[model samples]
Target chain A: MLNWIWIGLILAALLAAGVQDLGLVQLPGADAAVAEKGSRMAAVTEAAFDSAKTAVNIVIGLIGIMAMWLGLMRLADKAGLVQLLARALKPVLRRLFPDVPDGHPALGAMVMNIAANMLGLGNAATPLGLKAMEELDKLNPRKGTATNAMCTFLAINTAGFTLIPATVLGILAAAGSKTPHAIISTTLIASGVATITAIVTAKILERLPAFRLPPHDPPTADEPGAGKEATR
Target chain B: MRELLQAVATAVSSWAVPAMIGTILVAALVRRLPVYEEFVEGAKEGFQVGLRIIPFLVAMLVAMGMFRASGAIDVLKTIASPLLGAVGFPPDLLPMAIMRPLSGSGAQGLLAEIVKTFGPDSLLGRQAATMVGCSETTFYVLAVYFGSVAITRTRHAVVVGLTAELAGFITAIWVCRMVFA
Candidate 1:
């Protein structure tokens, strides 16, 4: 479905631009209407290229952050701290994901990811999240399809509860809000609701026949011990 | 009540990071782990993962930028304002609401613009800030996590994530109005 969403976005963009260019749909406050159609399209193309450059820059920006967190995470793992964290979070994780075996590394990674998100450490969260997903993927019976555990994990992370919201506070402070931290309580309440909703929705959806994963394919040579590994 | 909540938030925001780091370091030291060596090894893996995500990021970011640059977001705002206004949400925040699911930077820019225009203390500005703080960029998260694992079929994750985002948006508006108004 990501494929469909990506395609839909690109198509919708072109269609919106086309209708405006043809004067079939003239938006009241659209600045694109002021420019010539050719120029408007050129600007859109330019923005896409610029965003591509920005994307690469963002990845480069993430390297140091990712390295820092992942390194700490490795140390945590070596210290058995992550497992301890996982064990502490077992009651919550078990309810959220019953399929994941007890003491799995995915459990540790997921707990750490959620903890990072709650602290509003997004730079730390994303890499930890990716690590969790990869670890969960090891348990996936169907290689290319997202499993129930993966979906639930993604849902929770996407609607992650934020206790601090440091970035928003920084923006508010920069904009001169006398009470820049005022939104913190509201954000916590809202994000908490979002997380609960995500968990509930994911649980319900995964039970539906439509969202069920397909039958597993026979293990291929490249996936050595895939069957055995999944059983573990 | 509000003042107490705000005070707790301020305290957490000030000390949460240092506390987390300190706890981690102490735990590692107690366990006699070679913290530095393990860190370097993990950092190497992170660098590779960062490199791995570049193509996916470019694909998602370019698509998102093209959609916004095409004025589709503005069009969405114009179309959504009336319906949202009927429900008491400020129409002015529709751009940030729509962009929040698509692009983090785009939403941040919009939020900054809203705060500047409405004054940071104003109702709309507070609402926008709360909304920004309450949710993650759904599409971006989906892309990066799924892309890193090379998962082609997302199944229910997209629907579940968007539903959560919608919940966050509505709650943000409601809670902000209740407190700020």
Candidate 2:
């Protein structure tokens, strides 16, 4: 229900925004501002679209590179690189995620996810997330609301390591500031606090009956809420 | 060299400084508390998780770098001006807006451009940068975080994020109008 409501709101917003943009809706106060900054804005808008297209193309290259990287990493794992990392990660992962059992496949998944985030690799982080979820599901055996550990893992990922504040600062630098690096303080402050907050929030929320997975009666494979993500 | 030094210093002070302080404090406190064990275990898993996505991060960063150097971003900001101004954002911020869903650096590059065009201390530049700072890292969060967890129920996280960006933009403009204008 909540998810549906959110989807509706998003679609409505996008539609309304589109209509307003096309002049189908006579939105209030649109004209004056546009008139005032018209020429400068027009220039910027043109630049942004072209830049956006170029940005997408460059992203395409990165995606290709990342796919190759993943393949290489997999080969390394077959050669026991993954096992070595997994063994090394065991005690530490056990310490950080006590709820997750040692030797859990998700161990590798979680580590990979975090690694990706630290490097500011959104594209690379995705496969690890999916793999981790698969591992978590196997552990679950009885599908229901995800376990406390799963919930906690998600929270940490959301609040990620945020390693390269440089990228952000670098962008600031290019944007024409005398102090482009000023955001170093801000990203650190925000990302750190947000991660902490997410951990706490997920912990508290998980305890609530609503967030908890329902009882695993008979522990059947096909349960009511198992594959119901697209809905509510 | 000085600018590079300053950039490095600022980066360390801003991001690393906070991480070090916060992580130590949190680690200590959590270690002390019994329940915090679960969180620590979760946190320790974080490093490994980070390593996995390093490839993605590197690739994305390289892409972001290319975008910045390409001179393409300038054209985008101009095209988005009219539509964005309807919402009270300056056209100089158009790329920032687009990048909100795609990449942070993409937006940051645009933010840098705004600062260059209007001057960083200028009303337009400061507000835009501040808005970027205040706003969330959207696409990165969604694709990486949510995707990893298989969270079909984003629970309006995306909406909340973009809304926060829009609100910050408005607030920055309002505050700038009062202080600088």
Give a tens-digit lDDT track for model 2, residues A1-232. Answer: 2245334433433443344445555534345534653532343344445544654454455445444334433433334444555678887677556766766657776776777666556555655565566567566534433556666666666454455544555555655557655444444445555555655666566556656555444534454343543221
Query: What does the lDDT come to for candidate 1?
Result: 0.84
lDDT of 1 by residue, A82-113 (tens): 78878888898899889998888889999888
Model 1 stretches astray by more than 4 angstroms? A32-38, A218-232, B1-32, B87-89
Write out the backbone clash pairs for model 1: none
Chain B of model 1: TM-score?
Answer: 0.81
What DockQ does every candidate get? 0.69, 0.08
Standalone chain B TM-score for every prediction? 0.81, 0.58
lDDT tens digits by residue: candidate 2, B1-181: 7578666655654574246335434544544544234334333444444444443433333333333332334334545668777876676666575565446555665676666777776767656665565445554554444433444444334443444444444555566566556
iRMS for model 1? 2.0
Q: In model 1, state the lDDT of residue A193.
A: 92
Tens digit of per-residue lDDT, candidate 1, span B60-86 = 999998898888877777778789889
Which prediction has the highest DockQ against the true structure? 1
DockQ of 2: 0.08
The candidates' interface RMSDs, in order, read: 2.0, 11.6
